[model samples]
Target: MQNPFSEEQVRQLNEIGKLPPTEQQAKLQAMFSTFNEEQIKFLQNQQKAVQEQGGQCPFCMIVEGKIPSQKIYEDDQVIAVLDINPATRGHTLVMPKKHYALTAQMPDGELAHLFMVVNNLAKHLFETMKAEGTNIFLANGAAAGQRAPHVFVHVIPRYNGDGVNFEWEGKKAEDEELAKIREQILKEGFEIKEEVEEEPEEIIEHEFEMSERIP
Candidate 1:
């Protein structure tokens, strides 16, 4: 199959990939804004092709017993295992038996079950490990620091002087902006109604060029 991206674009994409996962999506979105609709579609196809290339997900391997792990809990729908590289002792990762890139891709029942397992595991850690506190974290996407393509929830047991920091710089929002956000979310059906807008004329102008072949 022919490569869809130009050499320069490929280089830019590589650089974007090098950024922290939390920052990568924003940078990629900025870069994507420069591409035409056809280019965007080509990028989407490229993404689908990459996923179809059958790259093994490590979490899936763990579920299949191909990769050894410290299995703490398991059920028909999900499994819980200790993280090899833990932020704290007794840190566990709870994931669905089926592979999913994001929680949003999972069914509501399955997603709920996954978290219920997490809650129980957190309590277990607190009682068994005598943890002072706990942090239940889910990195939903690359933009949220998700390293693996498979989705999982982290349950990290916390203790005094653990030195683990999850803090971020605080930004103050104006009251008007906060009210607008609250109103948007609190609207009927709990859905935010965004105004539909058309793409820029230039972004719609470029045609899809699969290859630079001259007939």
Candidate 2:
């Protein structure tokens, strides 16, 4: 499938992949310096897919022992585990117990709780692993680099000068054009409402039954 995230955007991000640490930080700030409404919505939708799956949550399967993972932390509402393919040392994934493909799919309470877990894990990695800092990331869709259709947050430890990088090049836009984009987003935003009611309750019940059967 064609990536929903633009090649231009990726290229801009990849530029950081080539830069020195100080320069990379500057680029990162500049990249997000002008986020428009559409971009925000796109990212929001990207993260919200988790709840749409009716909390027949994939992360729950891993926690329940139906799926295998290098365990990090496990609790009733969340789980933290090592990424099978990590980008940095002590790389961990934080996900909610309920299945959510994207952040937008998550109920506000669940999203808040998920981030709390992520923050706690990041603190542990920084203190226990003795890292300088961390990168907390969420990929909401395939276009945004999400391989699985589950909502997850990546906590990657950053040292003083580690070469691990994710950078890209971006095209500049005129103020007029940016304004038009913002207007369109606001127009659409009015039409967008939380569709939690659409989620199938049966799926939740089935998932709960499966969870009980697991040893």
Candidate 3:
């Protein structure tokens, strides 16, 4: 099949070359390196359109029936669908009902609900598909392999001898830097911590119940 990505995009992919195989990240550095001025402009235009018409966001279009997708699971707050180009057997994507390019942009309650759906799907895939393990992935920016601006989480199933891997080097953190980062996080305030207080325990249980319904 002809590459779905444009020539510039392909060049960009080549520039990045093969990413650390263990990371399982898309070879985006090379892809972006190939993006010409025109392609970059096109992407910018699409993003502007998304911002102007919240209801018309690409992911929202899929969710609102304006666009078509291979759906696996869905509810009021989120949707799980088959990836058009799956990396592994039973690879799926989980997206929020709202259109947010990055997870950081999503409301705490919405992000919580989205992850709740992801957790449920992970359990279902392991039990029904008999997967050995699973990888939950999120890419934030173009540099991070985010092709579409819409925020979606990838739920990739792995089995013994499946050949999929997710290895990355973790940098050692200096004690002073770590302490400074922790202090900053404490000062900025966090939403997840606060939202958990308002949500009832049964709601969490219901999320798990919904997971059991997925095949």
Candidate 4:
């Protein structure tokens, strides 16, 4: 697209961008009022292009209902859905409605709520699907085999000879190395203390009864 903003308008927008979030919207509205019809349309298209680029994550699209999902549970902060390409039967995914690439980026309260949803889904599998055991798995980053950009917890129901393998060859670390690793983790934990104010936990009742087999 051609440059839609003149030098003066560009300067004004830069000033607007630096404003506090609460003030920027009113400033932007006032700025937009001065634009001609064609300039306004061009700005609108540019804004839309930016949104499309930023919101293209598949999980975000699913949350927006732009993409269909076999959703079993949904609330203000989280959603649980059956994994279409499941590891085994009743392999469901629980994720935050907001897009977060890593758990580290999420607020402590939201993270707590997200895992609470995961726990309930696990319980639902055990009760409704008669799952003997379940694995609450999360691959946090690309290095950890995370295929999607959005973070999600996988609730995979376990059975005897289910053929899902999360095994790895066990290696014993030296005592000194293990001690050093533990120390590092403890130090990091101390640095990242929870800061979000704890909200009263709300009881959420969800019905997740479904056929054990997907159609």
Candidate 5:
């Protein structure tokens, strides 16, 4: 069976179709910088297998003890585990204990609690694991590379010369275009709260990147 492409992944491939042949090749090469030919093929096969498994949300099973994972943090509201497909060493995933199929579906309180855990965990990953930097990745939909419908925030600890790069091809926008986007974003974006008293979350410190937790 063919791998089920995310909507965003499909859009990216379709955009590549608009490029000149030479440009298309270059863009394609850059987008796949982390994987070699064999790895890419293997990923495709693995993705197909995952898709064929009937769209199960693996993270939910892990939370329920049906799937074993090295959990390093948990609270009444959120849980943290090592990612199966990590971008770098000490990569961790923070998810809400309550199910939210997408980030947009998450309540403000749960969202705040989820990121609070992510922030604290990222700090520990760097200080204890010797990671120099970190990347916090969240996806709302398939276009953002969300494989599972259950929302997860990836906290990837970065070291110097780590091969992971999430850069996209840059493009210039006119001042008019930029101004309109800025206005629209400011108009519709989140309103900052002066005080959001979130519940204190629990943290469990563990010492390894193995057991479906890290790179």
Candidate 6:
């Protein structure tokens, strides 16, 4: 795509860019001072628009019907929707109806129930779509590639040559190292009121399975 700015605007921008680092901020302030009230308001509105897009929670809007989505499953606690950007044909995303900013923030009851819904959807996708395999993944934080503020459980159907890859270092640690890690998790003393049933490990390997704040 071509540059959006007009000739004069482009020239002014280039001139501003060429200014010394120490002078750039003052130059920018003076340049904006030339803009009239309407221009100033327009710039402010543009800034706010960017902030809203970056900071606004999208899944919350979808649950509220403010954003249109084709929901495949929904109940009192959680909802599953077709992923707008799919890794494969039958890719889906399951998330809580109640927005939890982080997966760790979700109550144990909600977390257990959410995966049950996820499990059912994955089965339907694998059977109906005849996927060779499947991957259940959660990108927990920004470092893990989480784009939205909302927690999303990605149910991706995998074929033999799907070209999707999650390259891990597969780094190994000592048994003593692993035992110490286990000890810290046990130290936290967090236990659910009732234990939740776990799914078979034969199917998709549920990613993001880890304890908080590695010891």
The deviation in Å at residue 182 for candidate 2 is 1.3
Best by lDDT: 4
**What lDDT score goes with residue 14 in model 4?**
87
Q: List clashing residue pairs in candidate 1.
A: none
Q: Considering TM-score, which of the candidate structures 3 and 4 is the better prediction for this target? A: 4
Candidate 3: misplaced stretches above 4 Å?
A: 1-57, 170-215
Model 4 per-residue lDDT at 60: 80
| Candidate 6 residue-wise lDDT at 41 | 51
lDDT of 4 by residue, 112-183 (tens): 878877887787787678877999999765556677757799999998899899999999899999999999
Per-prediction TM-score to the true structure, in the order listed? 0.64, 0.59, 0.59, 0.67, 0.63, 0.59
Best by TM-score: 4
lDDT at 194 for candidate 4? 59
lDDT of 5 by residue, 87-128 (tens): 897788989865555554455677877886788788888878
Q: Which regions of candidate 6 fall more than 4 Å away from where they truly are?
A: 1-55, 179-215
RMSD of each: 15.9, 13.4, 11.5, 12.6, 12.6, 15.8
Task: State candidate 5's TM-score.
Answer: 0.63
Model 4 lDDT, residue 135, Cα: 95
Error of 4 at 125 (Å): 0.6
Scored against the true structure, residue 45 in model 2 reaches a CA lDDT of: 55
On TM-score, who's better, 2 or 5? 5
For model 6, name the residue pairs that clash. Answer: none
Q: Report the C-alpha lDDT of model 3 over 1-215, residue by residue, as the tens digit.
A: 22356676566555554545323124432334455546544544655575676635567677777788777776666788888788788898999766666665555777887887888888888777899899999887666878675789999988988877687899999999999999997896766434442332343112234634444
Q: Which stretches of candidate 2 lie over 4 Å from their true place?
A: 1-60, 188-215
Please give the range of 10 consecutive residues that has the lowest summed lDDT in model 4: 206-215
The residue pairs in collision within model 4 are none
